[model samples]
Target: MGIDFYGVLQVPRNCTDLDIKKAYRDLALEFNPEKLQKENAKHVFALICEAYDVLSDPLRRAVFDQYGEEGLKRGVPGPDEFIKPYHYHGDAMRTYRDFFGTTSPYANLLDYLQNPAYECMTKHGKMFQQKQPPITHPLCLTLHEVFFGGIKKMKIHRLVYINDEKTKTEVKEKILTIPIKPGIRPGTELLFPEEGDQNPNQTPADVIFVTEDRPDETFSRKEDDLLMIYDVTLEEALMGTTVTVNTIDHRTIRVPITDVIYPGYEKIVENEGMPILDDYPRRGNLVINFSISFPKYLPKACKELFRKGFELAKIGGGFNQYETVNKLVLADKILRVDFNEQLPPT
Candidate 1:
């Protein structure tokens, strides 16, 4: 049977990347190969490490999802720049000793609970030794591409020392596609092995994906929620019409307005006695506001109607009035669309 990454780590599929890393570190430290002398014990520990290697990498996870373990074994193409590397086997074993008390495979972890050695192991040592790299490299990625998942390829240059002389060398750099789970906040980093210069003494630096929001797209500032602003005319607002709202999904969803429609950006949804917010009884409202604008290239008759009916103020050399901050205005004129309200009383 294939290894189950989530199952091996004992974390939910939706668990954050940091949570997954922590889980792997805890489990690996407990069952490190160096700590285990028995063949079976070492075999099981290797499986855990393999699982971590695949799951921790976004690209490897993608490969695993499609081709399983056998597929990921295929080599990824990149330039072979000589790197200073460390033995992963050594690091895993050292981490195992640090997290759990017994480095011996034969040592019963349960028994360690009764002994004092267990405390010493976890408390005294660092999980991985830190070594400085002779040179540093930089990489950058976009927010959406990182969140939805994508690939990043770059190159790093390193200086090689020959007889105390430096020669510039370049290595093909590849960060396989990462599959970022939903609801992941930005500023999360993913790490890889030996990802540094010639004297690769440094622990792999994390690929931090920072979150950014586009101004035109309305998105929820919080988890498990969405926000939008709608503009309606005085007639539609009073008549309680069906407003077809274009959503982030690029489709229109019709929502009904009520007799309580107001002129300003009104919080139609507020807490129902929730102590954290004002007791407005509506918990999740898309504050609908009202506004007035004239068709610039209006027919002479329409311009006459606006001039005769409403009060106007001067704006950019044109007469206008302060109204609700109309977020849904399209250029030229607003589309005053009233979706069909009644369907033959069906």
Candidate 2:
């Protein structure tokens, strides 16, 4: 059976990283082998270290969460770098000494362990390797690429140690491959563990790729729905029209609009929008917002024809008795032209 890291840390699965750190600190102080009198103190202390080691790092924690201990200890079947598991150093006393920076595991550990500015001194005055902050980069993905899942390759340069003794270092280029899945939203991040600059004293920083959607000219995405604009003349809007919509999947759909398009009218073509990736073959609706264009000037003859047409169709409208407003006024004062632009169209 796999060990429950959340149970060991006494935290919820969705708990924040700070919660895990605080839990480990309290537990480590209590179970330090040098301080505890129990016979199982070493075993318990080692378990705590192992759990903290996995939960502290984002990459390791994600693997442990998804595949449990078996997948984490043995490699998962993939080419992605995130699947590489980090093993515990097998020295609980050393782990404790490195973290609290104490001469002895339990000797006055609480005094300076919380101090941020103090430089830690380990056993025999040897400092432990420190993990560095992650280097983050924006990954802009086009809508086309997002619709069709593919792999993206990135070449990055970082400083690396040349010798095992940590005597020399040089810059090296590393190629990172990220697999982009269909329907991945903006702000999804891919973590490449410890791929940043290398130093003798510090562990390299993890590289993070934050996903962002590139601006598209023809379509805009709103959650799962896709929006498109179609132009229509006033005559077509009143009488109804049929439109041929060119979809992202290269399908041409002839949608018939039989009902009259009133002001602020919008039509929905079902299951024609963005793909629902998790639920394969399912899709959201395509929303068509009609933009009706009015003629600049209406001739007297044409206007008369419109009135007769409406009367014949029995469309209820007081066309002859309609009130004309030259300058709109509110509370007996004429509103400015700029203010009229701000008003919703009737």
Candidate 3:
């Protein structure tokens, strides 16, 4: 039997001209070698193009309908004379480019298919069309992942049509693997072109994954710097001590507190923060904020001993007298100190 032109394009034999056009356009795009990744894509696409060519023209279609393929090859007679034999002499790729007015039709294939109006514009030489906006999604990452780098898999569900019918649709899940680079800043965006939701009329939007650092109990990130609060007892704050910090990578870092830690004292550990993105060797500083916790109350004997000790430790200077008095009262209890008197200039 002769090749079924209507079956080739998947249109019924009684289908209208509009139906034939729609079917041909849809199948052509679906089977286009650049769009479809099938083994016999090129061969199948050529067959569809041939079917469309013979079925779309009024004269050729009438001849094929009456005489079939062999009749067309033998030439059909018209009222005045025999109509010349019909053959698909045009290049398939050239025809597709002319129809879409674009060499890369797959880039916006979905848009053309979904928006008939846009396709009409393209057919009339209006090649420029507004692109769909990029879709952004937050990708929450832990401090450990940002510090050491890791891979995150995100599952995205999108609506896919079962066939050309718009009524029937199915939700498809796609897993996207995102590489988290060391020191990638929060709000950094990774773009996947044309991977967003699909529509029959519009092209798929670009997918954007924005990085967001999840809150960590041990450290809070500020740009590339890591901030941590270290609590110390009154004795440790006053006397020399060592504070051990647990890092995000399960490593212990020892921070020495030799000097007395006054209120508002911040220890800066250089090159201990998050690694610089791309340049992993460089790093920011880790800032340690100290909080001193004093005992709730001190016994009368203990207060007296602390008073006597401050007097003996003549840790003096021009301001030694005031320092000694302030320490004596403040060490025993929480006392507010105000510098009311003017001091001699150095």
Instruction: Say which candidate scores most in lDDT.
Output: 3
- Model 1 lDDT per residue over 188-235, tens place: 444444445442222333333333433344433332234555665554
Clashing residue pairs in candidate 2 (N, C-alpha, C atoms within 3 angstroms): none
In model 3, where do residues sit more than 4 Å from their true spots? Answer: 1-130, 164-169, 308-315, 318-346
lDDT of 2 at 46: 91
Can you give the TM-score per candidate against the true fold?
A: 0.32, 0.55, 0.55
Q: Which stretches of candidate 1 lie over 4 Å from their true place?
A: 1-169, 187-204, 218-220, 263-346
lDDT of 2 by residue, 23-85 (tens): 777688778877776779989989998898899888788888888887889867555554565
lDDT of each: 0.46, 0.76, 0.77
Q: Candidate order by TM-score, highest to lowest?
A: 2, 3, 1
Model 1 scores worst on lDDT over the 10 consecutive residues at 271-280
Residue-level lDDT tens digits of model 3 in 1-346: 6788889988887888877867776777777888777779988888888888888888888888898988876798898998988777757876676656665746345555776535433442223244567899999999999998888899998776787755466789999989888899999999888786666545678899999999888799998889999999887776657879887767899989767777898899998898988677799889999989999998887778666756655566442344454465455543333445535458
What is candidate 1's local distance difference test score?
A: 0.46
